[model samples]
Target: MRRGIGLAAVLVIGCGGGSEPGGIVPLSEEPAYAVVLSDYTSTAIAMVRADGTAVDERWVTSGTETPGLVAALSGDVAIPSAGLGDGTLWLLDRFRTDVLTRIEVPSGEVLGQVRTHDAGEGESGWSSNPHDVALIADDLAWISRFEPNLDPAAPELERGNDLYAIDPSTMTRRGMRIGLSQYDVEVAGADGTSATAFARPSSIVRLGDVLVVGLARLTVAFDGAGPGAIAEVTIATGETRLIELEGLHDCARVVPAGERAIVGCAGFGDMAGKRATAGIAVVELVDGHVEITRTLRFGDDEQLPVASQGVVHVDADRVLAFEWGAFDPATPDRLFEIDLATGSAVEIASSAGPFELGSPLFDGAEDLALVPDASRGLRRFVRGEDGTWSEMDAIELATDLALPVRHIARL
Candidate 1:
């Protein structure tokens, strides 16, 4: 699914007032703020206040060096960590350009940019295809490289399928690289030949000192997927342990839900058969041990559909999830509010077209949620006083860039 964009440097476009051209200006002081929108090939940002007023739709626009405020991102898959709460955002230009771009959300300053993969001279270079990043400290962070390096002679640090520690301040590799090759499992291929299930680490979340990472565990050829697994890495000691979920497959998205964490497993197969194995796993972090508390299968006498993505926690007992509409083109993608306690789902919204809904971004402070719709721009949903969600005005994207709205993140 990798494709090249040929981005080489950071790009900035000034849209807000009080700044020079190609520079970013800080939005007005508010307790809550903006949303960064990306359509894969290009990007645009909207600065919105806590009261739902948009300060600027074109807060940042396309430029010569970069797509927008950050490097061009991959829309092949929606990245979970679109924005970080610490006044910063780390944008991953995966697929072709394995670059990670960091930006200060408040100031719109490009703090640092680095290519995560080793680009050796000529034919020797390989792309690591970074997926998600988790900030460990002011100077420390961990990023998951999704693709495995097939070359046995590759350097241990350059070898994919592991979490690499980096200095968030410098955007450079730091400390020891945490290898995940040991978690790989062997499985039967479609032709009855045995294949290696590479531990394709994707989404990661930091829970205190333990980092919970989701493993896709797909075959090297990317044609088949094995059971999903979660790796818990100790922050201080760098110790790692793999917890395999027996029936879950292609489980790649992880999100923190209050004191617990939820893992969304998109089981492999065609739409009809995939739902039988697809589900969500509820995990709990007790003391320092990671444990699976419950597993909710999507199609087992439930309303939840297969291929759940963009899982967002809505307190300890509830979460907002998106269901892919690939089973039928006429079936629009849906946004569901799931009750973890009851294993029930309520369809909150549906896209206008199949597979048009991207990741959903929730702002707890404002009791608001933003769902990126390719056909309708950014759809806003507000929580009522009685604790119910209702659709509000869609955020206007008044830019000339004709890219479809696919992903959104908060500033």
Candidate 2:
């Protein structure tokens, strides 16, 4: 049975919609579209009003609630149990602020039931980790699964080649594995600890006619991943081509800029266990093959970064990316805008560390990008009239409403 709370039916509980302003939808209004928060440490999926304040502590679900990742489909949210290895997809209605359906994914958890927050602990059996869900249409989608038992010392554990086609209506795998190509990565040991590890997939993007996938298999615990590969998947035929990249680790943030895919790559120093600088891989797909047209590296002066996430395409050539190094107070995170034509990357904004950087969300008009900083609050980057991206005012999240949100899952 599907479980959900109706939005319009909550007026009596003071949880109903709020008043209007300027004949415009008030920021206080029962969230025209609420911001869903998945705090893994807190073990809950909470919500903040549309204005980025106003916390609803009770608006959470029960279970072994580790909010790994989420995808916004139209107005609904798709949250998979990547961290939990649960074979379920929680489909929540953003407007109603409730889960309307629970769809299963390939190799989903055997505990097939709607889970509650206070549910007792149980021995959920072994299963493949469901990494991400990419919807191609209303009832069809592609889900990437991770192979289990990734041994850090064993370099062979880094090879990941799992992608599946599924029908949402039935929660079933539609065909055989859409094979992923393997890339060899060499990891070096810094001290007694071996840096060698397995390469795994990180992010996925859809280009003009192909789906771009990021694979970084050799990831040593906490030290970060080894050199990665970006694969181009044909949507119509489910055919995939694995294009290996050099000096590139995790391209968590990949965006489509016109004819090419702007991939933010971390350099070789990451494999040595030190916080290293990052580079940009400017790639274009031709005849279903991945080609690296050019690679842009930061000068020696810009050496305090590792990898990037929440990469967004601003205009025709300008793309925004957030850089991550170590995340301590001494190490500040960076935001950059890359010029595709010149391969020039300019630092746009920097944030004090000890805080987590949430995924980036762009306004419907694509004029503004919003990222939540768990330690401070929320930060906004706007597309300037001059074609450059400029920092806008950032508001701190209400410390009392919810725990420092790990990531603002969806806007």
Among these predictions, the greatest lDDT belongs to 1
Q: What CA root-mean-square deviation does each model show from the true structure?
A: 4.9, 9.5
Alpha-carbon shift of residue 329 in model 2 (angstroms) = 7.0
TM-score per prediction, in order, is: 0.86, 0.64
Q: Where does model 1 exceed 4 Å of error?
A: 1-22, 25-36, 50-53, 61-83, 122-125, 327-329, 385-387
Candidate 1 lDDT trough over 10 residues, lowest sum? 1-10
Write one digit per residue (lDDT tens) for candidate 2, span 1-411.
322221121111111121121111122223212233444322233344444444443233322221221211222233431111223444433222221234223211221121111112231221234445566664456655443234333222222235655555444345545545344355654454556444454455666667787665544453545565677788888776767665455554455555677776654443253224355676777675668887655533244233356565566666666666363336666777666566566776776673367555555365776676766556767776676677766655434445454444332
> Model 1, 1-411: lDDT tens per residue?
111222335544323322345556655553244455566655555666655457666555444233233453343333336345767656676776787766566666666666776677531556788898887777787889998888878877788899987777667667458899998888887787999989999988777779899999999777777777899999899899989887778888887776788898888877765787788888888778798998887767545655368888877677888887754447788898888678888889998868788777777877888887888877889888887899998765654566566766554
Candidate 1, position 299, lDDT? 65
TM-score of the candidate numbered 2? 0.64
Q: In model 1, state the lDDT of residue 376.
A: 83
- Clash-forming residue pairs, model 1: none
User: lDDT, candidate 1, residue 307?
Assistant: 37
